[model samples]
Target chain A: EDQVTQSPEALRLQEGESSSLNCSYTVSGLRGLFWYRQDPGKGPEFLFTLYSAGEEKEKERLKATLTKKESFLHITAPKPEDSATYLCAVQAYGDVTSYDKVIFGPGTSLSVIP
Target chain B: DAMVIQNPRYQVTQFGKPVTLSCSQTLNHNVMYWYQQKSSQAPKLLFHYYDKDFNNEADTPDNFQSRRPNTSFCFLDIRSPGLGDAAMYLCATSRGRTSHNEQFFGPGTRLTVL
Candidate 1:
């Protein structure tokens, strides 16, 4: 069975504090890994997509890196606007029956105290 | 800008009443999806439409149905909403079947079942 897990269900940080969130997954074949940020009362916004091990992407204060079994989203100097739930999803390569299925992990809620 | 758009950011419906959420995209994507999300939980895939083909997840209830009148418009219809169905309904779109395509999501509709 394909499953995705994220650690530290919630995190509180002071303004300018840096932290990292983890997303671990077990799947048949990894096609791509995605990171998204969702604010309260809104849907998720696309952040980064990591296709292979050792792949990384960065935007502003957010950087995402992926490995064979897991992915990490690193945040630096976060602000109140940056505080949101971070979500991760994985799409498997094979299994046509499961195509278009992107399994998501429980998101990490981040609160930046301003 | 090419983006996904969802109408009625907040929806209020009485218990056992029917409701419909609409989504449209200008990105000309071939796939559209609907997901249900509760507080602090992963977004659950309710169903998706690949082109004109409709696909439902195994655990999705029959009360939920969807329509894709054209490539750019999609609708989610709930025959009878329960209190448990009061959550955020998100709409997402992807370019094609390629493994690397990332999905873009709309702002989402917050359904309040009274």
Candidate 2:
């Protein structure tokens, strides 16, 4: 079965702290890995998509790196605005004629205290 | 900006009552998805529409039904609401079934069953 797991269910850090969240997956054929940031009472916002191992993507203060079995979302000098639930998802290659399956992990909730 | 949009940011319905939630997208994407997200849990795929074709997840209950009237609009109909069915219903859209395509989500609808 394809599964995605995220560690450190909740994290609290002071403003300007740096931290990393982990996402591990088991799938038949890895097609894509996605990262999203969701604020409370709202939907997730798309962050990055990594397609292969060793692939990395970065935004202003967030960087995502992918590996064969895991991915890491590193936050650099995270501010209070960066406090949100970070979600990791994986898409697997399924039967071509069938719908591709995307599995999501229980998100890691991060809090930045000012 | 091209984006996904959902109606009724919050909904309340009585148990066993039928409810319908609507979503529309301006991205002109060919694929649309509906997911159920409970508090502190990952979003679970209920179904998706690839153009005019509907694909339902095997685990999805029969009470959950969806309709795609056109490229930009889709609706999720719950025939009978249960207390357990209270959750956030998220709508998402993607261009196509490409490994690199990132799904864009709308502000979800929070459903409260009473």
Candidate 3:
């Protein structure tokens, strides 16, 4: 079974504090790993997609890195506006003829106190 | 402007009553997805549409149904909604049928069951 797990269920950070969130997965064959930011009572916003190990992508103060079994989302100099639930989702190579399922982690709730 | 849109950002329903949530996307993506999310939990995929073809998840309840009459619109219908069915329903779209594609999400509809 393909599954995703994220670490540090909740984190409280001071403004400008830097931290990293971990996401680990178990899949038969990896297709892609995705990162998303979801504010309370809102939908998730797309962040980054990592397809292979050693792949890295960055946007503003956020950086995402992927490996064989895990992915990390690093936040640099966080701001209160950046506080939200970070979600990690993984896609596995299932039946090629049909659309595969994307497994999502429970997400890490981060609070940036300014 | 929101590329993906969900109507009735907040919905209220009585127990065992049927309700429909609407979603429309201007992106004209090839795939649309419906997900259910609860507080502090991951968004759970209920089903998705690849063009006009509907794919239902194995664990989805029979009380939940969906329809995609055209490429731009989709609807999620809950038949006999229960208290447990109260959740945030998210609508998303992707440019392709493959799971590797990044999905664009709309502000979700929060359902309240009485």
Give the root-mean-square deviation of each candidate in angstroms: 1.3, 0.9, 1.2
Candidate 3 docking DockQ: 0.88
In candidate 1, the second chain superimposes onto the true chain B with a TM-score of 0.97
Candidate achieving higher TM-score, 1 or 3 = 3
Question: How do all the candidates rank in terms of DockQ, highest first?
Answer: 3, 2, 1
Among all candidates shown, the one with the greatest DockQ? 3
- Candidate 2 scores a chain A TM-score of 0.97
Question: How do the residues A1-114 of candidate 3 rate in per-residue lDDT, one tens digit apiece?
Answer: 888999999999999999999999999889899999999999999999999999999999999999999999999999999999999999887785655668999999999999
Task: Identify the candidate with maximal lDDT.
Answer: 2
Please list the residue runs of candidate 1 whose C-alpha ends up more than 4 Å from where it truly belongs after superposition. Answer: none
lDDT by residue (tens digit), candidate 2, A1-114: 999999899999999989999999999989899999999999999999999999999999999999999999999999999999999999998785765789999999999999
Candidate 2 docking classification: high
Candidate 1 per-residue C-alpha lDDT over B5-114 given as tens digits, one digit per residue, 9 for 90 to 100 = 99889999999999999999999999999999998788999998989989898999999999999999999999999999999999999987555468899999999999
Give the per-residue lDDT of model 3 (tens digit) for B16-93. 999999999999899999999999999999999988889999999999999999999999999999999999999999
Q: Which pairs, if any, clash in model 3?
A: none
| Tens-digit per-residue lDDT, A1-112, candidate 1 | 9899997899999999999999999998888999999888888899999999999999999999999999999999999888899999998765655564589999999999
Of the true interface contacts, each candidate retains a share of 0.83, 0.81, 0.89
TM-score of each: 0.96, 0.98, 0.97
TM for chain B in all models? 0.97, 0.97, 0.96
